[model samples]
Structure formats: C-alpha cells, structure tokens
Target: MKINIFKNIFENRFSFYRQQGRRQRSRHSQKKERKIGKLKDEIIGLRRRYEKVKKLKRQLQHANLDSPEVKTQRIFQGHKDSSHVRKALQCHFAVLGAVKHKYRGLKNTKSKQSLAQLVSDKLIKKYKCKTYCKKLIGCVSRRKIKRKLA
Candidate 1:
C-alpha cells in the first residue's frame, strides 16, 4: 500500500482553498479518471465472476467425480422416463400370454399389436410419458430395442 504524497498535498491544498472561501474546481481530467476507474471496477467484477464460474465447473468435473451421485448418474441416464414403457411392455407380454390361451384354435396374431398399443396408450395418459411413449411402437416391433430397454 504505497501512499501518494502528492495526492495528500493536493487534497490539503484544496481543503485550504475551500476554507479560505476561494473555490478550486477539479481538473477536467477528473471526469475521465472517474470513468476509467468505473470501467476498471466493472472489468474486475467481470473477471471475478468468470473465475468463480470456471472454478465451479472445474470442481464439478474433477472433484465431483468421486461422489456417489456422480457415479450413479450414468447408471440412470437411459432410464429417465422408461418406467411406464417397461410397465407397458410387461402388460403386453401378459396380455399376449392371455390372448394365446384364449385363441388357441385361431390364428389371429395381427391384432395382438393392438392390445400392446392400447396398453401403451392407456399407460401414457396415466404416466404422462408421451415423450417415452414413442418408444412403445418401436419396442412393440423391434426385438433389439426391447433388449436395450429391458
């Protein structure tokens, strides 16, 4: 913390001028200095905010890696809203089994998709998972998607 002796001397001189009833206005450069100081303060504030955000990002990337939540985060990445889809799948399998027994003598397998679709439709309204319901049609026909989902 270096003190400017010239600044103190000029301030004392200004006070003395005020006391002597002789007004002494600051130089025109004072306005420019004030604007520059305000700009410096704003720059410092911006740098501090940027550093704080960067520190938080670094902490999240490196330090939070050992946290249990971080470890388990990827475990549930694909399961965001798939509970209803899984339930509908189970209902489809169950309804399939029941329909197979009821139509043991007939060969009406094309209509089986309708039962699964009905289950998916009803479960979507109940679970409010239309975003996930799109996968219903895929899982109904594609064995690979069902394998991945299950």
Candidate 2:
C-alpha cells in the first residue's frame, strides 16, 4: 500500500512538470509569430516604396532626353563664358605688348610667323586661353607695332 502511494505522488509531479513545459513552449511560439508578422508588414511597405521610386526614375529618364534645357546645355558645353573670354584676351594683349617691347626690330614675314607660333603655343598651354591657337596665330601675325627707332 505505501509503495502504491509513492508511485501516485511521483506520477502527479511528473505530469505537473510536463504541463508547465508545454505552456512555456506555447507562449514562446506566440511571441515569435508576432515578431514575424511585424517583419512581413515592414517588408510590404518597403516594396511599395521601392516600386514608386522606380516608376519616378523611369519617367524622369524618358522626359530628360526631350527637354529643351538639355539641348541648350549640349549646345553651350565647351564655349567659355563672356567674362572668361575677356580675361583671356586681356592676358594675351599683355603678353603681346611684352613681346613687342623685346623684339622692336622684328619685321620679316618668317620671323613674325615664328613669333606668332611661339606666342600662340605659350598662350594656349600656359595661360589657359580658350581661343583657338590658329586664330591667335593669325591675330599675332597681323599685329603692327610702331617702333620709335624704325
């Protein structure tokens, strides 16, 4: 009779522990499912936002190609501003004045051409002048200086 009573107590304790473990597992699983649901909602929201941005990008790509602003930008891409042109011309004249002072008696056609080529090269390479070198050469060759000695 005492052995049967001990067995009954042990079975009752084991069953109680088993029910407690099952309850803890169910609670953990519920918490995990709640977190998964929140994550799924966030993913859906991000996908919608991505789709909207992609649509806008496609629209902009198509619209930009036919825009007048783009055409104007292309037309004026390499042309310097008027202020830059003025500054470059001023620098060119200053250099030319110095060259004239150094070579007061330079009169021959070959010597003038050589001097023009030299000036053009220097102005383009060193001074960062945007004017074409050939045009500069022509201008230099045609310039006349009045020398007091000659």
TM-score to true structure, per model: 0.27, 0.40
Highest TM-score model number: 2
Which residue segments of model 2 deviate by more than 4 Å? Answer: 64-150
lDDT for each residue of candidate 1 in 1-150, tens digit (9 for 90 to 100): 136888888899989878665332454467778999999999999999999999999887777453333434445566665654455554444444444544564465656655455444543444444434455444444676689999
**Model 2 lDDT tens row, 60-140:** 778755233344445457886576555545555545644664466456556655655555544345545525444554563
TM-score for candidate 2, residues paired by index: 0.40
Q: What is the lDDT of every predicted structure here? A: 0.58, 0.63
lDDT of 1: 0.58
